[model samples]
Target chain A: AQRVTQPEKLLSVFKGAPVELKCNYSYSGSPELFWYVQYSRQRLQLLLRHISRESIKGFTADLNKGETSFHLKKPFAQEEDSAMYYCALDIQGAQKLVFGQGTRLTINP
Target chain B: EAGVTQSPTHLIKTRGQQATLRCSPISGHTSVYWYQQALGLGLQFLLWYDEGEERNRGNFPPRFSGRQFPNYSSELNVNALELEDSALYLCASSLAKRVRGQPQHFGDGTRLSIL
Candidate 1:
């Protein structure tokens, strides 16, 4: 069974500080990883995908097959970056997502 | 292009009652997905429909069922709702083609509260 785990239930950081949201997965097959964020009063939206290898909104996540991790990272966190971050794993070709418990990110001014 | 839309922003029902949630995909999207975001449970895949067929479903019970219409809209019906069933039901849409991974666009979600 494919499973995603986001270790932190909540993470707080001051503005301009670096942010890293940890994510780990347990899947036998090669997995597709993604980061989704939901801002206050906003719907959940895609943050970044490992396959794309492109950064979005200053965030990037690299899929580490060896370690079975895909941690989302940002060099400089902004106040607006406060949101709930979810790490998801796509179940092979089925494209069904298995999401983590989610990490609530709060950036203090 | 309009994003995915879900009906009844909030729904309240008592135990043993039935709850029906609706979702309308993007204008040209042919795939619709349902996910349940319960407190601490995160987002659990519920159902996936494409081309009016049920493609995939999570480990939910038989009481949780849904169908996609020919026009690509879908409805999720929860039979005999229980208090534990209370959660935010989210609807998302993406292109059916698998060649390139199209990110699933999610809606605001329906807040289903079972009393």
Candidate 2:
């Protein structure tokens, strides 16, 4: 079975502090990972994908095959960064996406 | 270009009734997907339609069925609605069949409530 897991249900950090939202997956084959964010009163949207290796809104996630993890990280947390983040996995040949329970990040000023 | 669009931002239905949800893929998109986001549970894939064919489906029961139109628009019908069926139904679109790294554009979603 393929599964995505975000260990932290809620992560709180003070403004300017570093933030990390851990994500892990279980798959037999190579996995494509993605980070999606949903802000208050807004639609859920893609934040970044591991293949792109691009940072969006000061956030970056590295896919570590050895650890089976793709944790999202930011050097300095901002108030606007607070949102519900979900980690997803797309296996080869499957058009469907498997998503994690999601983690809510709160940046307190 | 317009993003994926879904109808009836919110819906209310009685238990044992049936409910239908609609979605229109973005211009030129050939694939449409449906997902359910319950209160506690995470987003779960419901169905996938491409080129007017059902490519794949989640673990949901046959009561949850849908079809795609020639225009690339789609409709999801849930039979025998139960209270547990209340959720946010999200629709997404992709240019082609989902490859390894293709990102899906999403709609705001329809909030369905079962009484």
Candidate 3:
């Protein structure tokens, strides 16, 4: 079974502090990884994908095949950065995404 | 360019009633996807439609069905709606050829309330 696991449901970080959201996946073959974000009253939007290997809005994630992890990180958290983040995996031939439960990031003002 | 659009921002239906949600993909996108997000729950894939055909579906039951039109628009019909069906139904669209790698653009979603 292809599954995505997000260890934390909610993460609170002080403004200017570094933040990290953990995600782990289980898949037999090579998988495609993506991070999606949803802000308050905003629609869900793509943040970044492993294939692109780029950062978005100061946040970045590295796909670690050995550890089977794709953790999202930011050097400094900001109040506007608070949102719900989801880790998704595209399994081979599935043609659909398997999303993690999501982590609600809270940046303290 | 305009993004995906979903009709009826909110709908309320009682048990055993039916609910229908509509979606219009982006201008050049031919793949539409449906997902359900219950309160305090994550998104669950519902169905996928591409090129006016049913491409794949999640673990949902037959009661939850949908179809894609020739124009690439889609509709989801929930029959015998249950209380658990109360959730936000989200619609996403992507390019048909590079679907897996293409980021899906989303609509604000239709909020369904089953009472």
User: What's the TM-score of chain B for every model shown?
Assistant: 0.96, 0.98, 0.96
Residue B4 miss distance in model 2 (angstroms): 1.1
lDDT scores in order: 0.91, 0.94, 0.92
Candidate closest to the true structure, highest DockQ: 2
Query: Order the candidates by DockQ, highest first — what do you get?
Result: 2, 3, 1
Q: Is the docking of candidate 3 incorrect, acceptable, medium or high quality?
A: medium
Model 2 docking category = high
Fnat: each model in turn: 0.66, 0.88, 0.68
Model 3 misplaced regions, further than 4 Å: none
Interface RMSD of each: 1.5, 0.8, 1.3
Candidate 2 residue lDDT tens string, A17-39: 99999999999998899999999
Predicted structure 1: lDDT: 0.91
Query: How many clashing pairs in candidate 1?
Result: 0
lDDT agreement of model 2 with the native: 0.94
Clashing pairs in 3: none
Give the higher-DockQ candidate: 1 or 3: 3
